[model samples]
Target: MRILILGTGGMANQHAKHFAAIEGVTLAGGVDVDPARVEAFNQTHGIERGFGSLDAALAWGEFDAIANVTPDSIHHPTTMAALNAGKHVFCEKPLATDYAKAMEMTETAERLGLINMVNLTYRNVAQLQKAREIVQSGQVGTVKHFEASYLQSWLVSKAWGDWRTESQWLWRLSKKHGSNGVLGDIGVHILDFAAYGAGSDFSKVFCRLETFSKAENNKIGEYDLDANDSFAMTAQLENGALGVIHATRWATGHFNELRLRIYGEKGSVEIQHRHDWSKLLTCLGDDIETGTWTEVAVDPVPTNYMRFVEAVRSGQNLEPSFRHATNIQKVLDLATVTDRDRSEHKV
Candidate 1:
């Protein structure tokens, strides 16, 4: 598969390396508005063409699929362009800034008979997949409670503002670009991860938000911003499961501490990401306090890109369609319905 990558962002670089390492993929050059980045990418990879625009690259490269790794704000337009050009797309998630654009992109893909893979990378983790099986197989009776969190320490600093003041085109800090901030940034993953663990369709969410700290979003810093610094939510799962998701950028000493736990009538499943592979601990309750959480050893799954290649090759759908990406964003949209002014202390 010849995979053309969009954007020259950090995530795009990571995608290039992962695809290049795979046996069947070719890292066909990259494109960005920055001429310096275009030349640098081509020079670094020993590739010939670095087009000035996405359209030019689409015209020049014979790409089977595109790795749409651009910022959330432009994910819709970029991925739509690729799909319109008759290429399958594997996009990184929060597929768009909001739900509507995401839906549009997904609709277009379906209309054109193109396979779309939203890169919810955690779904590709082997142990997490196995954990889902354990729950469904009646090793765990019926899921009852779920708790998940993704905590980061970057915002706990004295200079998180000073450090980021100049870095505002960042997709995370501006509400004008999308929904509430931290929720849009990390909480999207937190909630979706829980929904995925429950193996239940996301039903509804009621969110509570707090901004423990405030920062300007523009490099100009002229505008008072309304983005989330910390957020907590409780949601009802489609399968009669109860869930809570807590995510914040301001938690101290925790770079990215994520814990996903689901408790069921017969057992429980807990999975944590220790860098890459999900470390899974399962407890299948037997008698009174009989089951103990035991670490389950399992090799991690291969890259999500491989699944994209297989889908493109075999002419199959990557189930839990990319349209599901829009559904997740809708949850984010619903969470921010009360946060219109950003002056409110809580939503």
Candidate 2:
């Protein structure tokens, strides 16, 4: 499979590296608004060509697929263009800035019979995959409750770098810069984590979002740091499970982590992915009586990148597909409404 990397940002490097590492895939070219950045990305990834814009690359039309590493807002248009051009797409998370756009992208991709997938990076965690398997296999015996959180201390420390001065970090904090804040950013991951691990989809959500002041007047140069910094939600799953899901950039002490605990009639399962390490623990059968939790050995799973290549090759869609992402976006969009009206919404 020949791939064109859309957007030569930080995430694009991972896309290029992963695709290039695949045995039969080629990194044919890269695209970015900045010519210099695209050229540098091409050189770094050993790609043969670079284009200053998506239009330029599409006109050349040499690649079979596109890795859309563009910003949250740009995903809709660029992905639509790629699908219209008869190219398969592997897009970054949240799919689009809003539910309507995400739905459109999902519908178009499906109607065209194209392979469309989202990079819900947490799906690659072996523990998460294992937890899902356990829940689905009836070991947990009807999930009743769950709690999930995605934590990051980027705003509290320089572990990831100074967000006050960096454009990459600044853009995420500003709504005008096409950011949906912490709620739109990591919120999707935690929602997916809880729902996927529990083998259920959210049917109702009540959300509260908070945007903490990070600067004087919350203004940083041309950027308005008004995007949400934290959010907490209570939701009902399709399988009749109740779950609490939340995410925050102000979680001090933690660099980046996703933790999920699923409670069922028979037992409970806990999964944690901190930094880069993941582990799964369970309390089942006789162990549930003593409240003993035992660690479950989990094997690694293929990443979304690898699955995208496989899906492209086999002419079949895969999990975390555009349709699934659109449903996640529906929940996210309703989250903003719930926050505004201070009320719960049915998804």
Report the Cα lDDT for residue 25, model 1. Answer: 77
After the best TM-score superposition of candidate 1, give how far the Cα of residue 7 lies from its true spot, in angstroms: 0.2
Q: Weakest 10 consecutive residues, lDDT, candidate 2?
A: 271-280
lDDT per residue (tens digit) for residues 69-142 in model 1: 77777788888889889988888877887778888998999999999988786676677787888887888888
Pairs with steric clashes in candidate 1: none
**lDDT, candidates in the order shown:** 0.76, 0.93
Show where candidate 2 strays beyond 4 Å.
none
TM-score of each model, paired residue for residue:
0.89, 0.99
Clash counts for the predictions, in order? 0, 0
